[model samples]
Target: MKPRSLVSQSPTSLKLTTGCEALDACLRGGFPCNSLTEIVAESGCGKTQLCLQLSLRAQLPISNGGLNGSSLYLHSELPFPFRRLHQLSKSFHLSNPNIYADHNDNPCDHVFVQNVHSVDHLLDVMPKIDSFVKSSRTRLPLKLIVLDSVAALFRSEFENTPGDLRKRSSLFFKVSGKLKRLADRFGLVVVITNQVTDFVESSDGLSGLRIGNLRGLYSSGRRVVPALGLAWANCVNSRVFISRSGDGICEERREDDESGSSSVGRRDRRRFDIVFSPYLPASSCEFVITREGICGVG
Candidate 1:
């Protein structure tokens, strides 16, 4: 007889709060544990901010809308934004005093960051994270893993090569499988940020009519789609997109210390669209980024 498998095969619904109320609502509680969630957005649209916020939120106990664990953040293209994470940690600590009452203990200490310069480095480091998660005996268990800008590593190496397509596709499956396995085995919420590529109409003039960069992720006459093609899309369980409004004007809320002018910052209108997901609806929500965090559009 063959040896029995050790890992659990069933899926889980337990989630970690994203820490942003509007984003959490959009995700229907939070990012689902034991699954991979992808966040795709244009530059300067708060992808890293959201990731940073989630790192802090994941540290919250289960009763307080958290996974009661720590997070692993892997960045390939950009340096980890420490200032923003610290700012958000300050706010998060103030709100959840019970969990972070100690003034000396920093919330950021719970988040483990790994910066990978190349794809091979990333592939190598991921398995080590699995090892840490499995052997971790700390009070806070490992709960989340974040890869900011997943496509950048491939886009540079692949360089629009047809042969590299197969290679890229293979790497996609391999990395995603590793993450998925870890998620199922230890119930980790995997979040990956992907870059975008302009969806070019390549019908070779067979059709006269054009649909304005029609693509699978876009809705109602849209342009540009998430990069890394279908293989990457299939690997992730959920895809949440963020885009800035044409005007890029976010609402201004009054603060006690600041005057009306000081309160009003360049708060751009951002749309959080759930392009596709098994549990989440094919819907979108409006939200803005502030010093506090992601807030409702209203």
Candidate 2:
């Protein structure tokens, strides 16, 4: 073989469009294939909304910035939002009429969902996905694998003791390893959502290792950080954060008012930030959740 330096450049990894222009731009294209991306956020900040949009976006043709494939969503808690998904499907179809013009199938029908109740259940499910993708019966190639929330299974499964912590970290590696293998084998884009906990400032240096933008882990004027600590942080290739902030303004405020304020209303102003990523710098953009879907604001 020729020396390593003389080898040809590798092909660029595939990216799945987020369907939001500003957010997509901030992501420097979109969520990348062959890597694990973590979406960290507090409750009610549109984490699931963004994931729902991606499920539909993945079905678009490759020319339209999609993978032209299907998505598998492994949700850890709560019922799958079938009704909301149907609503977004309508919006997605309207947004891309030409893409679906030749086909009559519902895009929402293509998203496969499974609830993972515990750590064991998730571990059991991961190995089987490889076979599912390779099965000839699958009509569409799988491009996206989303774990709606990774923190739920571990929240109560392990205690804070040293032995349990080691076990928890070991399990983390197992799941991430399998996901990475699948990503590399199939050029898949894996997106995992994580819950956030209130950050408690400690003089000890251990707390300083928490990840976020350079300004620290404050969201919505309150300090918060992704759950599962640093052990889980090392498992992913990228981390994106979603947050909300506002005063008493109406939640449905359409645009920035005459007061020259960017915020909508109470809990209306939402922001998306790149906490850390191998391919993207720490950047941020604003976004809104409308009846249609999540759209990035200027």
Clashing pairs in 1: 250-267, 250-268
Quantify all predictions' global Cα lDDT against the true fold. 0.78, 0.84
Please give each candidate's TM-score: 0.84, 0.90
Clashing pairs in model 2? 249-265
lDDT of 1 by residue, 6-93 (tens): 5554344788886667777878888998899998887777888888888888998898888889998888876678888888888887
lDDT of 2 at 61: 84
lDDT of 2 at 64: 89
Q: After superposition, how far is residue 212 of candidate 2 from its true place, in Å?
A: 4.8
Candidate 2, number of clashes: 1
Worst 10 residues of 2 by lDDT: 246-255
Candidate 2 has a TM-score of 0.90
Query: Which stretches in model 2 have alpha-carbon errors above 4 Å?
Result: 1-11, 98-103, 210-212, 246-263
Candidate 1 C-alpha error for residue 190, in Å: 0.5
Model 2 lDDT tens row, 1-298: 7564423645556799898899989988899989999999998889999999898899888888998899999998688888989999997888788765666667876799999999899989988998889983645699999998899888879999999999999999998999999998888999999998888777886666646565567677787878998999999999998887734345435445545565445466578889889889888888888888888776
